[model samples]
Target: MDDDGVVPLSGGVMKAVRLHQYEVRPLVEDVPEPVITHPFDVVVRVGGAGLCRTDLHIVEGQWAAKSNVALPYTLGHENAGWVHAVGSAVEHVQVGDAVILHPLATCGFCRACRAGDDVHCEAQAFPGIDTDGGMAELIKTSARSVVKLGKGVEPAAVAALADAGLTAYHAVKKAVPLLHPGTTCVVMGAGGLGHLGIQALRAMSATRIVVLDRNEEALALTRAWGADVTVVADGSHVATVLELTDGKGAEVVLDFVGERGAEHDSWAMTRRAGSDFVIGYGGTVDIPTIDVISTERNVVGNLVGSYNDLVELMVLAADGKVEMLTQTYPLDAVNDAMDDLDAGRLRGRGILVP
Candidate 1:
């Protein structure tokens, strides 16, 4: 590291995909490699950076006001790689260690962090959203954000777990206590997160898993991942779920879409006193207050997982219980990857490799 806090780039520059303008495609360009700027910082050699739909929203300015991230930052929240360098204060991981990053860089001493709820840390930086992120040859994170992968686990194989899988795991983990052998856990919107939610629910609980998606293929894929039932997300889907659950609705309904009237359907399919965990965004959830008071339903919001949550999720990934249908792309092909993701042409999460 130099006096200016910029470490000398051995090769002078590295390739990265940056969002130079809101509502436009990210540009792949040569940029300086990241360096440790703080005693707790770590630089990761990017192996796989998962392209998420949130990146699309960021590019569209949906998150500009919320994240308040400056322009022209590299974008990729789901990251996994080997540790290339570490600040002096970092000790749990060292160079050459394969790791996945928790999306949030948080202070471990906060009350929420102390409670293992780092997602709600008083102060946090959401990489790829609120700061420069991985979609590059190198990325910078903090010591508290790195989780070492277990044996036989490669960075690319589990990169999507960084955010997408972690979020899914977090939601399912919350639903575990409410679920039992005969109970039904319905996952709405069998896309990237929904599919992963199915897998996490499968590995963590014995609840009968019901997956709903407009895409027949996504529903089929969820079935293979241990969804006990699949429902086409037509208008009648909610009624179908109620019928399947003997008119009691599902014990838990995780709304991954939470848009296009899906929220109403999700609420309709949730049983009395059951929980509705909202993960995905982009729509309004309009419900009558009478239903809330009569049903005693719990509406919860789910963000990404904590550092410890990532560690537990990695154990499931390393054991082959949860896997990502990763579509790999070179760093330069980020535009094409984003196109496929936006067009719904990609089957699973898109992973950019250096």
Candidate 2:
């Protein structure tokens, strides 16, 4: 049988950008459009699909073994659009409704799903990673993954929140207990994911926010968005963070760029007994065994947000409490968008609209 949630298409074709090989450019081409094939399946007419570093990693073959995705699959994980059709048993959304999708389509009966921790659902299929994604004219997903957009919210404007923002929200939400008033939270990397972490931390807690990034523009942007301090990620970023935290280090550290030794710095910036949340991937975390026992630092790993987490994030977006900077491109410009993200040229999230 076909992999779960990736059944045979009924008919028709639509344009999509697909990666044919690793270390090669993806091309925009026509692919089979999606149709309802299951009782819970729903098809969405693509409005926007977010481009993230993980997409770059996928293109570079970093996720090839881990994802086990067949070559030439459509590559987009963060998606939002108008509902084109619904399955017979789907009751949450309908035709013409604008909605943002949770990144993974999960079986509702899994133990993790029953506990509202669907990110770890045993039978989960990550769309745009292991299967067809929404970087096309239309795509298929389960009804459980769709969250209807409220009035005044455009699908493209908030599509990246489906993954990038949701990830940051999930990390920050878990660290809320450590962010009480007078505590300090340091956010590493002010890019797509970390920027949202900044906004969510500010909205959810009274902790002072300090941001570090290799880009001055990103630092300035985060400062304007509510970071109490923004430091350039020069050679002395760790010392700078410790200095800003009165030499004790921050109570909580959010690492949005976990590669290039940022993982090491994230742990170093966390005060003793503080929690260090790792959201980005592709990095190794190596620490002395004695340090872990003596300092009592907690290194937490985060995945994409759950379905309920996405719902709460949308509430913040609806209240105007959370907003992300985004740039939109036509589906045909997928290569350009990918290059911009790879070079760190894009100031915010990049989205592809079809």
Best of the candidates, lDDT: 2
Where does candidate 1 stray beyond 4 Å? 1-11
**Tens-place lDDT digits, model 2, residues 204-239:** 999999999988978878876789988999989999
lDDT of 1: 0.88
lDDT of each: 0.88, 0.91
Pairs of colliding residues, candidate 2: none
Q: Which whole-number lDDT from 0 to 100 does residue 350 have in model 1? A: 92
lDDT of 2: 0.91
Candidate 2 Cα deviation (angstroms), residue 116: 0.6
User: What is the number of backbone collisions in each predicted candidate, taken in the order shown?
Assistant: 1, 0
Tens digits of per-residue lDDT for model 1, 1-354: 766465544545889888989978989999888766678889999999998988888998999999888888989999999999987778999899999998899998889989988899999888899999999999998899999887667898889899989998999998899998889999988887887888889999999988898889877788779988888887888889999999999889999887778887888888899999998888788778999999999888988987888888888887888989989999989989989998888887999999
TM-score of each: 0.95, 0.96
